[model samples]
Target: MSKVTILGGSGAVGSIATETLASSGVFSEITVADINFAAARKLVGKLKGAKLSVAELDAENPHSIRRAIGGSAVVLNCVGPFYKHGPTIMKAVIEAGINYVDVCDDFDATEKLLAMDDKAKKAGVSALIGMGSSPGVANVLVRFCADSLLDQVEAVDIYHAHGGEKIEGAAVVKHRIHSMKVDIPMFLDGKFTTVNLFEDSGKALEEETEFKDVGTYSVYGYPHPETITLPKYLKGVKRVTNLGLVLPPAYAELIKGMVRLDITDEKPIEVQGHKVIPLEFAVAYILSQREKLMKEAGINQPMGCLKIVVKGYKDGGKNTYIFSMSSRGQGMGEGTGIPAAIGAILMGTGKITEKGVLPPEACVNPMDLL
Candidate 1:
C-alpha cells in the first residue's frame, strides 16, 4: 500500500492536493498533517476509500516532521512561506528516507534545497521542488518545448496571474512583498542579470503576451525559480523571464503601497507599547480587508492564467509554441495544489525515477501533468 503524507495538509493548497491525490485512487492511505490538528481532521473527514489520518506537525521542528512522515512513501509539503519551513522539512524528509515534493516558490530557499541534491541522491530519494502552477507547469512546458518542439531555443517567457479573492496566509503575503523589494536573478542579453519586480532593467520587451482567454495585462518582471533553473536545464537559452500580476488595480495598488513603505521588514517596532512587525501588521490589515476587497472587485469566482512561450527552431525552421492553461472557481489552491499532488503521486509511484533535488521542469513529463 502506498502511503502519502501532506505537511500543511489543512491549508488551501494542501486540501486541494489531498482531494486530488486521494480521488485518483493511487495512494492506499493519505495522512493529513498540520499544526492545526482539528483542521486536518476536518479535511480528512471528507475523503473516502483511502484511509485518512490526521496528525500534528510543526514544520519548523525536524524531529516533529520526521515523526509525521514516518512510513510514508511520499511527503507533499504545502507549507509556506517556504523560505522558513522548506529547508527544515526537506532535511527531515531526507533523514526519514522518503521521497519529497513541495510547492515552494521561494527562490533562495530553492537554491538551498538544490544544494542538497548530492545528499538526496546519496540517500536515494527524489526531492522535486516548486511543483506549483507557475513554477511547476511553466517549467514542464519549457522542457517539453526544448525536448520536442524547439531546437536551440533562444528565449522563453512565462506569464502568470491570479484574479479573485486572495486567500493566502500571512507568510505568503510577506514573501510576495519581500520578492518585490529584492533584486531577483534573470537571464537577459545572454547573461544573468539582477532585476527588481517592478524596476525596469533597461530591457525592452513586447507590449504584451496574449493569454488565451484572459485579456492581456502589462507583465512586470518577477523573479520565479524558472528564471534561474531553466538555463541549467535548457542549454543555449539566452533569456528567461517570469512575469506575474494580480487582478484588480486596487490589489496591485495595495501591494505597491506595501512595497513602497517597506512594510515587509521583519524587525519589530513598538506600536502603542506593543512590539509588532510592520509586515505582520500589513498582512493582518490586508487579510482583514480581504472580504471587502473581494466585494469591491466583484470577484466571487477566482481565476488564474499561466502561459508559456518558447521560441526557436524546430523541424529545420523557426517555430514558436505557446502552451497555456486557464482555470476558474478553484482559485490558487486548485491551480497550484493539483500539480503539486501530481508531483507527489509521480514520486510515490517511482515514475520520477531520479534521485536528487530537482525542479519540476527537470522531473515532470509535461504531457502527463497536463
Candidate 2:
C-alpha cells in the first residue's frame, strides 16, 4: 500500500498539506499524526480521498514518532518551531529508513539536518528539507533562473508577506519571536555574514517591497535557511537575502515591540500569584490582539505573495528575472503547505531519486514543483 504520514498534520500548514495530498490520490493511505488527537480527527474528517487515520504523535518522543510513522512510504513533517523539533524529528525519520520531506525554515535546524546527508544517503532515504514557501518556492525560482534564464547568477533576493489567517497559533508567534531574537544570515559580496534585525547592519538591508497582490510593505531581514543553503547551490552568487513580514503593519509592530521589550524570555516569572513564562504570555497577548489589529488595518481576508528577483548575466549581459506568486484569499498556509504536499508526492512516486538530506533547489525541479 502507498502510505504517507503527515506529522503535526492538523496545524495551519499541515492541514493544507493534508488536504492537498488527500485530493491528489497519490497515496492509498494517509495518516494525520499530531499531538492533538481531536484536531487530527477533525482534519481527517474534512479530507475527501485516501483512507485517513489519526495517530497521536509526541514529537519529543522518538518512539512515538517512529510508531506514528511506521509503514509509511513517505513522511511529510509540518511540525513548527523547527529550531526545537526539526533536527530531532529528522533523526528519528532517518532512523526509520523512510523517505522524508519537511518545510523546516530554521537556519540552525537546516544546518543540523544538512549535516545528516551522509546518514540519509547511507540509509538510502531521500530527504528534502526547507520545502516550504520561502525556501521551497523561493529556492526553486532561483534555480530556474540559473538553469533556464541566467548564465551566471550574481544575486538573489527573496521576499514574502502574509497574514489575516483565521487562527494564529502560539508556536507560530514564538517562531517569529525567536527569529527576531537571533542573528539574521545573509550572503553578501561573496561572503556569508550574519546581521541582527534590530541593529544597523540588518536595518541597512531593510526596504519597502511591493508584493503583487499583498500591497507594499517594509520587509526586514529574515534568518531563513535559504540565505545559507542557496549560496552553496547557486555557485558564484554574490548576494542572497530572504526578507519577509507579517501583514497588518500594526500586528508586526506588536511582535517587534514584545521582542524589543525583552519580555519574550522563556523562563517563567511571577505575575500575580502564579508563575508565568514571559514568552508564553507575550505570544498569548500577541494572538489575542491579532483580530483587532487586522480589523483596524482593514485586512478582511488572508492574503500573501512570494516575490523573487534573480539578477545575473544572460548572454554576458546584465539581466534580471522577477517572479511573484500571489493570491488574495489564500495566505501563508497554502503558500507553504502546497509545496510540502508536492514534495511528499514526489518522494512517494520516486520522482526524487537522490538519497541524501538536501534542499529544494538541489532535489526539486522548479518546473516539476510548479
Candidate 3:
C-alpha cells in the first residue's frame, strides 16, 4: 500500500483533498499530516475506512517536512499562506525525491518554485504547482482553447470568486492580506508588468463579469500565478490577466478597507499596554465579522467559478470563446481540493512523467482533468 501524505490535512483544503485521494483508491494508505495532530484526528474521525492515518508535521521545519512526507508515493501540499510555506515545503519534498503536488497560488512563490525545475529534474521529481481551482482548472481551460478551440490564441482573461468557508483560518486571511499589499504581476502587450492592487493599475482593469449560475460580480486584479506562468507556455498569446474576488462583495470591500487602512502589517505594535500583530488582529476581526457580513450579503453557502475568455482571429475573422466552471452548494473543498488530489494521483501513477516543476497547463492533460 503506497502512502500519501497530506500536509495541512486538518485545514480547509487539506481535509477534502485527503478524502478525495482516499476515495480514488489510488493510494492504499493516506496520512493526514498537520502541525496539530488532534485537529487532524478530528477530521479523520469522520472519514471512513482504515486507509487513513494522522501525523504531526511542523511545516516550517525542514526535518519535520521530510519526516512527514518521506516514503509517501505523492505528497499533496494543501498547506497555505503559500507565500510562507509553499517554497519551504516544496524544497523539502524535492530533497526527499517524492512526487509532489501543491495549490500554490502566490505568484512570488510560484516563481521561486518554478526556478527549481532543473533541480527537480535531477531528483527525478514530477512536480505540479497551482493545481487548485483558479490556477489549476483555469490553466487547463486555456490549454484546451489553445489546443482544440482556437487557431490563434491572442488573449486569455481569467476571473474567479470563492470563499465562505465554514471557518476562516488566520493563514488564509494573511495570504489574502499579503496579496493586496504586494505589487501584482500581469502580462500585457507581450511583456510582464507589476501593478499595485490599490492603485490606478488595478482599478483601471476592474471587471464586472457574470459567472454562469453564480451571478455577476466585480472582480479586481489578482496576482495568481496563471498570469505569470501561462504567458510562458502559451506562446504567441499576447495578454493574460487574472481578476478575482472572495465572495459576498461586502466581504471583498471589507478586506479592501483593511488594506487601505494599512491594518495588515505583520509587524507587532503596542496596543493598550500589550503587543499585537496588526495582521493577526485583522484576521481575528475579519473572522469575527465574517458571519454578519456573510449574513448581510446573503451568502449562506459556498459558491465559486472559473471563467475564462479566449479571444483571437480564426479564418481571418474575429473569434471569441467563453468557458465557465461554476459550482454552488459545495465550495473550495471540492473545487480546489479534488484537483490537487487528482494531480497527486497522476504523479503517483506515473501518468505525468514530466520531471521538473510544471503547471497544469504544461503537464496535465485537459481531457483527463475534465
Query: What's the lDDT for all of these models?
Result: 0.83, 0.93, 0.88
Quote the lDDT for 141 in model 1.
Answer: 83
lDDT ranking from best candidate downward:
2, 3, 1
Worst 10-residue lDDT window, candidate 3: 45-54
Looking at model 2, which ten-residue stretch has the lowest summed lDDT? Answer: 166-175
Residue 125, candidate 1: alpha-carbon lDDT: 88
Which portions of model 1 miss their true places by more than 4 Å?
Answer: 202-207
The sequence of per-residue lDDT tens digits that candidate 1 reaches over residues 51-75 is 8899899888888898888899999
Clash list (residue pairs), candidate 2: none
Clashing pairs in 3: none
For model 2, the stretches where C-alpha displacement exceeds 4 angstroms are none
Local lDDT at 170 for model 2: 79
Q: What's the count of clashing pairs in each model shown?
A: 0, 0, 0
RMSD of 2: 0.9
lDDT preference between candidates 2 and 3, better one:
2
Q: How well is each residue in 1-370 modelled by candidate 3, as lDDT tens digits? A: 5888999988888888888877887888889999889999988888875378888999899999998887798899999889999999999999999989999999999999999999999999999999998789999988988888778889999988886678678788888888898898999999999888889988988979888878888889998999999988888989999998998888878888999999988799999999999988888898889899989888888888888899987778778999887778877777888888888888887779899999999999998888
Candidate 2 lDDT, 127-161, residue by residue in tens: 99999898899999899899999889999999999
Q: Can you list the residue pairs that collide in candidate 1?
A: none
Q: How do all the candidates rank in terms of TM-score, highest first? A: 2, 3, 1
